[model samples]
Every structure is written in structure tokens, then in C-alpha cells.
Target: MVISMAAASAPTTEYVNMYTLNLFSLAGGTTTSSTANRMVIEFGRGNGVVLNGSFTYGADGALSGGTLTGFEEYYAGVKGFDVLGASVPVLDFANLINANDFEGVLNAIFGGIDSISGSPMSDYLNGMAGPDTLSGLDGDDYLDGSAGDDVILGGNGADSVRGLEDNDTIEGGAGDDDVNGNMGIDLVHGGAGNDTVRGGQGNDVIYGDAGDDGHVNGNLGDDQVFGGVGADTLYGGQGADVLRGDEDNDWLSGDLGNDVLYGGAGADRFLFRAGSGVDVVGDFNYAAGDRVQLAPGTAYSLTTVGADAVINLGVGDQIILTGTGAAGAEWVVFA
Candidate 1:
């Protein structure tokens, strides 16, 4: 049964009547008491009412669930609810929740915005006001959650997407396409294409999948990056990071902080500068044409320890390139 309530922003002074209900009571249970299981607060305002509550299930207890309401905090169908202050995503069907971005799979189960957890609600999703989550299933489609915290998934095909505000997650499917996290903490996956991806603000995680010449930038955030195939360029901006150039020729640099870099295959370039924290490069193959580029006017010394090459650039700061034999001796090139 759907017990209703007013959205928190609704003024309670004008509410006619409010109901405190137990989940089992909706099925006509005995009475209202503390041990009555789940307790629901129904805020009835204007022409409708809506519900929001928290509950724990006892073997003989009740379970509480949130309800749908208009932006004005009324159970007035789907006029669409735009939350005030912070945010709560109006993602799929019926399940209009607040202050929480439920993370699971995008099962589009709603006729429009607002969803119950784990239901595939939409084939294509458009972002609404407030923190919204949108997902795409099994096709090349477009997704743009206009504002707030959003989650976008391009399950397959060449797709275009944008997360305009708050923390977001965007996954681009098999086809080459564009995906951008405009604000907040974001996680992006470029699946199998020469894709261009950028993390606009806050902390972000980016992955470049198999394809020729992919470009990725960790604009803000202590990001983690993986270049999964072909020639790729990865930049770690203003944060401690881990960069793995996996497969084929790649170019990588640890722009700031202590970082770990891996030149996985073919010829690769690992760059560093003075004042940047000590960074390490895993799997630096000298025979594969991998080279370490140092900033101009930087003074440094090189040595080998048990197949590992270390560069000491004064002030006890150093860069260790591991996983190579003495052939790595010739791998260092100052830029």
C-alpha cells in the first residue's frame, strides 16, 4: 500500500491531517505503537499527499518505503519533483526518494522519472532538474541529466552524453563517442574507442578502453587512470595518481603529487618535472622503446638496483622505474 506524505519542503502549518502508519497496519493491523514496526509520516498538502519514512523489518514487523509526490510535496501524479537545497535524484518510476543516490544497476522500470531500485525503467533517459540519474540500455543513445548528481550508462553503441552538475558517473559503450562529467566527483569509462573524455571538477576516475589514440584528462581530483590499448595520452592534473598505460605505445605524465606510472607495452614516454612528488613506473620496458622525460634544467642522477632503475633528482626525491634489466640504463631521456 502507498502511504503518502508531504515533501520536507512543504509547509506543515496548512496540512489538514497527517497519518503515522505501520506497513502491516495498511493491511489492517491492530494499532499504532512503537513496536508497530515501520512508521510512516504522511504530509498532505494542497490537493494531494506523499510519503517518506524509514523502517527495519522484524520477522513479525513492518517495512517502510518512500512514496511519490509533486515538487510541491503533493501526491499529485508526476508533475515532476525538483528537490530544494542539497539534492535527491528523481531517477525512475514511482520510487521518489530524497537525499540519497541509490547505487545499483539501471533497471529502467518507470514510465518517466523516479524509480524503484533494480528495475530497468527506460531505454533512453533525459536528466531532469534536481540530482537525477539516467541510464541507457543496449543501444547507441543520448543521455543528459541536466543538473544534480547523475549516473549515465551507455550500454553499447556510439553514444553522446553529459552530466551537467554534481557528482556523476558516465560509461560510454562500444562505439566511439563523447562523454563529459561537467561537475562533481565522476567516474567515466570509455569502452573500446578513440574516445575523448574529461573530468571537469571534483575527484574523478577515468578508463580508456581498447582503441587507437585515446585521450584522457584528470582535470581535478586524485584520479586513477588506465589506458587499455593503442597509442594513448594520459595527464594527471593536481592530484596524487596512478597511471597505467596498458598495451601499445602510450604517453603519460604525473603532473603533481606522488604517483605510480606503468608503461605496459610497445614504446612509451613517461614524463616528470621537478617539485612533483616522487613517482614510480611499473613495467618500464627499455627494449620496447620506453623513455623517461625530465623537465628542462632539472639535475638528476641514475642508478640500478636489482633490475630496477632509479633517478635521483636532488633533495632525496626520486623516480623508480621497475621491471627492466640493465637495458633500462638507456631508457632515460631528459626533456
Candidate 2:
């Protein structure tokens, strides 16, 4: 049975009500009266009601007196009454709850409630207003942020979380989880295990922590990414992964392994390690000031149409030809 109550009192009055509440077997035996087995009371306003008596239970799985586990004390200046013993307060009353009241209830219950404790197949659902925090304690839970700039914590067991349409922070606590930043500038962290993260459509920051992490793209503006402590794959979709520069000069670095680098437009530069290769194909154009550096054990060939020099090298044979004249300066080496 669900019981809901509301109090109407003057600025300086104390109101109390009691009912013969049934203590069901699901709520545990009334003999387990210690604080560990007691019902948890959460108050909406700072100046609300208090639970004044203890609960009594009968042998037929029925309750004699209602359970009076705890009391909620609201600050004297606050305008609302304290909700007595309801697990979830119904603040849907008009003018009783504003944006601040909704937010205060969430902040008061951040780590205070345990949705699931001992079951592996259990799930908990919570709803809150803007700038709220939602934590999925255990059992592969799923969390959804309806609205506002919210924070979500996926505790354990390979959870899946999504931010609906606002700027949100989603964290994969400790499992092989999939996190997606649906919209807005979101921050997502794949806490541990091989996690897949996607930054939907804003300049978002994504971190792949410990395992092979893959990134989709940074759609607009400059996006920053790091594949932390693992073989990470980063893709700077549209905007340049600008390390340092001005006027659309973005930088991308493929650290460790054979990483492919591309310079799309503008005066972009490619930085490679000692054992890297840079390949150019198809009508490649070079200005007078452009330079190319070949690493050790690396080879480069160029074919020109007019007043240019071309070199072709073969096994055990060499050639050094140089001239601007039409005679075609040539040198040949024998096997």
C-alpha cells in the first residue's frame, strides 16, 4: 500500500499525524528495529514533520502500529512542511515545489539512498531536475537524464547510460560499458575495461581509460581527446585536432604504433617519429618554400614533366645526374 501526506500549518506551528500502517513482510519483520533495519525518511523542506513513535508488527504478516523510523527537521525560515516517512516524496503539489525545491531534494540524496544492495538482477530508477546527480549502485543498471545539466554515475556491472538533450556528464564506473553523449558539450569517461564512447554533436571531451578506446569525431570547433594508458584510436572528424596554432591550424598526433596522419587544408603540418613513412600520390603540388624530409632507410621518388630532375634507383645500381640544359645530365653504375 502507498501512503502520501501533506501538512497545512501557520508560520510557527507543529503538526503531527499517525496512522495504523501495515508493516508488510517485504519491509522486513518489525523485530528488526535497529537503525540498520529502520525505514529511511527523507524531507523535502527544511522545516517539516517528525516521526514520533516506533512501529509494531503482528504474526500474520500484518502491522499493528505504523513504523516511526526517523524524523526530518527543516530549517525554521523555510516555507514548506517536512515529509514524514515516505520513501519518495510527492512534491507534485502546485506551488509546493519550485526548481530550487526539486534540486534540493536531489542534492540531499546524492549518496544517501541505496537503490539496490544485494541482488544482481535488480534495477533502480530515479528522476530529478536540472544539475542533479544520479548514481546506479549495482546490477547492470541503466540511467537516463530527462533534463538539465546532470551528472550520472554507472556504478558497476556493464551499465549503459545516455544524456537526453542537455549538457551532461556521464561516467562509466567500473565495467565494459557503452556511454554516449547524445547532445550538448558533454564529458564522458570510460572508467575501466574496453569501453566505447561517442561524442554525439558538440565539442565534447572523451577519455578512454585502460583498454582499446575508439572515438567517433569532434563535429564542430576544436575538440581535445586522449586515449589514456592504452592503445587509443582518435578521430578529429571535421575541425582540426589543433595542438597549437591560429586560423584553423589543428594538430593530430598518432602516438605509438603505425598511425596515419592527414593534413586536410590550410598550412597544416605533419609530425612523425624516426621510423615513420609519409606517402604522397596523385598530382601532388609543391611550392618553392615547401620541404620534405626523408628518414633513415626511407626512399622518395619524384617524376617531373619539364625543367625538373627525376631519379630512379634499382638494386646494386646508382645514378647521379644534374643539369638544367637539354643535354640531360646522366650518370650510370654497373652491377
Instruction: Using lDDT, give the best candidate's number.
Output: 1
User: Candidate 2 at 254: error in angstroms?
Assistant: 11
> Candidate 2, which segments miss by more than 4 Å at Cα?
1-128, 215-221, 242-335
TM-score of each candidate?
0.56, 0.41
- In the range 9-112, model 1's lDDT, one tens digit per residue, is 12222221112111111222222332222233332233232223222345665443232232222332321122222122323222422222222112221223
Per-model lDDT: 0.58, 0.41
Candidate 1 lDDT for residue 202: 70
Cα RMSD of all models vs. native, in order, equals 13.5, 16.8
Q: What C-alpha lDDT, on a 0 to 100 scale, does residue 236 get in candidate 2?
A: 43
TM-score between model 1 and native: 0.56
Q: Write the per-residue lDDT of candidate 2 for residues 94-155, one digit (tens) a residue.
A: 11223334344433332132221211332333333345465655556566654667677777
Q: What is the lDDT of residue 45 in candidate 2?
A: 35
